[model samples]
Target: MKNIVIVGGGFAGLWAGLTAARELDLHGGAARITLVTKDEYLTVRPRLYEVFSEGLRAPLRPVLEPLGIQLQLGTVQDIDRQQRSVHLSVAGGESLALPYDRLIFTAGSEQRPLEIPGAAKFALNIDTFAAAQTFDRHLQDVLRAPDRPGRLTFIIVGGGFTGIELATEMRTRIRAHSDAATARKARIILIERGNVIGRHLGANPRPAIEAALREAQVEIYFGASVAQIERDAVRLTDDKHIDASTVVVTTGLRANPLVAQLGANTDDHGRVIVDEMLRVNGAHDIFAAGDAACAKADEQHAALMSCQHAIPMGKYAGYNAAHDVLGTPLRPYSQPNYVTCLDLGESGALFTVGWERKPEKSGAVGKQLKQTINTQWIYPPSGSRESILAAADLDGVWPPAV
Candidate 1:
């Protein structure tokens, strides 16, 4: 039987697997739909900062099992476009090469390594589930110990969305493990090279974001960045130094390096460039989505490396890939609406609509909405198969209007 394979178990891969399965079922086709990923569970990446919370993941089997989509455990080590096959390294130190009639690549991104001195040794990250848990464990270990001079200072490198959220959420976490006096004296500093926080979010939301950070007792060290992170001190670009026991880096995220193995058209960050149909720019039988894909959202816009873009892009890519076998025309991919909801901890949250990021909601109301989006909206559609299929439909509830 002809196989339609999707790699990665992120937002994109999960959506692609479901939509593709739905398409096959609709067409009453015999084509097999298989999802090969490093793990069977989908990591709730957007909530990694909320690692302190109980929910951080949902199993792919619950969703994918409803459909006939087969789950293969492995990482795609390579893709040979010419051979139309992929080299996979599954669990148990085993290896296998599988051929495919259609392929969807959604490997996703990783935190960029800081090139600055001493960064690799001292800086912790909250990018992945593993990383976030490790950071939490270390924090618990530190705060549980008797008062140490620098152990209470938490230095967060980068003032972007992730950095800000982590910093704010961390305040409560640090306080939980320390006494009232130590918690009051605990230092939470955010270092950024730019003059403002949430620079990518445009100028409109900065005021609210800044105010929120300030209210959280989070200090912003703008206009400069961390030159180096030592065991107990962070050196600044301006030759200044701050004593900090814990350092968290959230500065950069580049597309997954695995996409480079395809040798297709990729941007500077190593994300595969896809055509309007979300197909790989220079390769046949290949499609990509999520952070691994650099797809044009509109005439003048390109999809960012976010779940907002990934979910819709995955739907389109999977629909198109399925149509290739169904002998139907493929629809062009587009997502004109873009929104951002940044979590601000105790100060509530900020919600913005459109690319300009004009604030639609702020404070407690925004926090509630953000919680809903994070907890319920983005999760895999559960309940009936009909409900999940309806949600995955290209023209239905998904690719929601902004």
Candidate 2:
């Protein structure tokens, strides 16, 4: 049996494994599939903001085991593509080497660090669970500090989803820290380099998102960029500065460094360039998905890096990879539909459809839809052997509501 190895257990990696296993079963288990991840649990990253407020998290083991996927808990230190091998550091610091007949690289993206001085040393990011938890602890510490001007100030760099969500959620989180007197009076400042916040979101929903931010009492600074980050403040390119006890950087993210090691065609963001089939050009046995890949969506090439794209891309990559190995017909990936659901905290949420960002819902009703997508749709299904296998069909449509 051919062995297929997948790296990174985020949305892409996990979905890849499940899809491949299902395909292999159709051929009487002619191929063995293994999934590698730093943690055994699958993080509901879309709902991380809710985790801060509602402490919502779901387990992935129940979903993987039933799909007949062997889970290897470890970190992929390096990939030897030529040898079809992966170098891993398993739990307890033990090292292991594994080989594969086919490989899928789904390692996700990380926050783009600011080059500004003191930014990395003091500023926090919400890209990872650990970072979010650390920021939560920092908020508690700030609340414990004596009531002061800077103590109550929180600055968020970026007016995108991450920045907006963090600012809105922090407002509520800070208020619930302790008694009313000790609870810090929240002051959140969002800085964006664009002319207006959520510019990429277009007109339909941008105004609603902006209005929600303002209603939430979050200040906005447009046409602004972070010039420097200090121990107690953030300076903008326009010579203006905001004094705050905490600073969160969420400007943007880039593809994982592993894509560079592949030495294949890549975009400016360092994502491996793949065709509609999700295969790296000139590499037959290697495929890329998720943030590590730049693939086509509809007629447009190189879709944006988001879970909405990653999940479907993963399913396509896995099924196509297995099809190539088994000499079966392949499936072409095409997701013409696009949507964006931005969480706006107590002010509510915004839901948009299509590349134009058409408004589908807003306010409390929109927030409920966002919650449903985060807590339910994004999570893996219970790993029932038959059901899990059924979900692996390459053409299996997902996010049924989407």
Candidate 3:
């Protein structure tokens, strides 16, 4: 049997395992699949922001078991490309090596730490579920302190999606925290290096985002950069400083470093350069997807590092990898349509389609759509054998009808 081993349990890794399992199970000629992940659960990373506000999290075992996948809980320490084996450390600290006929590296991205002085030592991040939870606890702890200048001031670095969501949400979260005190007013500030906040989002719906931030009373600083992060304040490039008790950094994200370890072709962000079929260039029996891969979205541009691309890219990579081993014809990966729905907390959301920022919806209607996409659609189906298997089909396109 062809043993297929998949690393990582994020969106890409989970989908890859399911797709490969469905393909191999259908043929059953000679195929087996195993998934190795640092955690036993698949974190809904996109909704991690909601965890602070809504406290919602779903488990992965219920979703994977229905697909007949063997899950190995471990942290991958290194990859042995020549031997086609992965060295991993289990929860108990024991090391084990697992060999595979085909390997898919879907380890996702991590938060990019700032090089500014004291940023690493003091700043907080919302990259992972655990980190988000930690921040929530810290926020609660900050609320207990006496109301002072910096105590009620929360500063967020970066005016992108994550920063916007977090800043706006803090308006409501901090209010709740303040209600527990002597009615202290909280201040939230956002700092962006670009001339305009959400610059990459373009002009069509930029006004809506700005207006929403304004409505939330979330202060935004444009054309500004953080010079250094201090214990009780942040120094700006202009020498001005803001005293803040809570500081969150959401500047941008980069690809996982595992791709570089493979000595494969990679893009500027260190994402593995893959063909349209999602196969690693010049490497046999190896595939990559999600933030770890740089694949063509269409003839014009490469896929962006987002779950929107990762999910579909994973479906394609897993199916194509299994097909290659089964001698089946491969299908080229193509996703010409791209869309983004930015959640702006209580101020609502902005939805845009295509790379040019064509506005689709805004305000309350857009917020409802964003809620559905985040809360209902993005999560995996309950562990129903038939449904889970059906979801694994490579032909299936997510964001259906888009």
Candidate 4:
């Protein structure tokens, strides 16, 4: 039996492994599917800022085992396409060389730390489960600071999706755990390089975000950049300063750094340029999916580094890989639709659609949809093979434009 190795266990990698197994079963072909990652659990990364660590991770074995996919724990250091092998560093400092007939690259991205002084040591981020847990612990410890609301203030560095969600959510979470006076005086500050809040999200939904920020008492530093960061304060480019004991940098997002090792032509964000079939430019046996592959949404628009795109990309990559090995026809990948549901803590959410991002819903109903999408829809399917394969279909990935 041929071996198909999948690296990374994010949305893309998990779906690719499952979809490949489904295609094999459909074709009556026997191929070994193996998934290697640092952990066996799939962390619900988008929901990390909600401060609910208990439900953050979904087990992979319950979903992968029914499909005959094997799970291994390790961090991939390098991939040698010429030899069809991967150099991985397992836990406790051991090394392993795993060879495969075909490979799927789906390692996701992380917080792109800024070059500002003191950021590396003093900044906090919610990029991963471990990182979020660390921040949660730190937040808990700081709540006990004889300093009260001083150490309670949180400084978020960006106005993008993650940054906005974190800043808005911080208000409720911080207030819930503090005394009446501390809660009343609690502060959450967001710094953006643009003049308006949520400017990166475009004008369609920014007004709602700005209103939510005001209602939550979250401070905004518009048209300013953090020149330097210290343990207790941040200095802005305009020579202004804000004092805070907690700082988080949410500014940059490049593709997975591992994509650079493949030596393929990547755009400014380090995503491998791929054909309609999702195959990497310079490699024949290797395929890239999810955030790792810069696949086109249309002639002009490319897919973003999000679960909305990654799930379908993984489906195509898996199906194409299986079809290639089975000497069958491959399905061309295309995702012309897009939607976004931005969470705004207790204030509600904003749901937008299409390239122009027209608002479909806002306020409480939008918040309900956002909560369901984060807690139910994006999570892994159950242990049943039937359920896993049913949801792997690419066409039904995103809901109808609502």
Q: List, residue by residue over 193-307, the lDDT tens digit for candidate 3.
A: 8878777677887888888888887888888878888777889888888888888899888888777767798887789998888888988788999999999999897998788
Error of 1 at 377 (Å): 0.8
Q: Global lDDT for candidate 1?
A: 0.86
Candidate 4 regions with alpha-carbon error over 4 angstroms? 179-181, 395-397, 400-402
In candidate 4, residue 394 scores what lDDT?
59
TM-score winner between 2 and 4, please give it.
Answer: 4
lDDT of each: 0.86, 0.80, 0.82, 0.85
**Model 3 lDDT vs. the true structure?**
0.82
Model 3 clashing residue pairs (backbone)? none
Ranking by lDDT: 1, 4, 3, 2
Where does candidate 3 stray beyond 4 Å? 51-56, 180-184
- The sequence of per-residue lDDT tens digits that candidate 1 reaches over residues 255-339 is 9988888788789778999999999987768999999999999888899989999999999989989999888989999988888
Of the two candidates 1 and 3, the one with more favorable lDDT, higher being better, is 1
Ranking by TM-score: 4, 1, 3, 2
What TM-score does model 1 achieve against the real structure?
0.96
How much does candidate 2 score in TM-score? 0.94
- Model 3 TM: 0.95
| Model 2 whole-model lDDT (C-alpha atoms) | 0.80
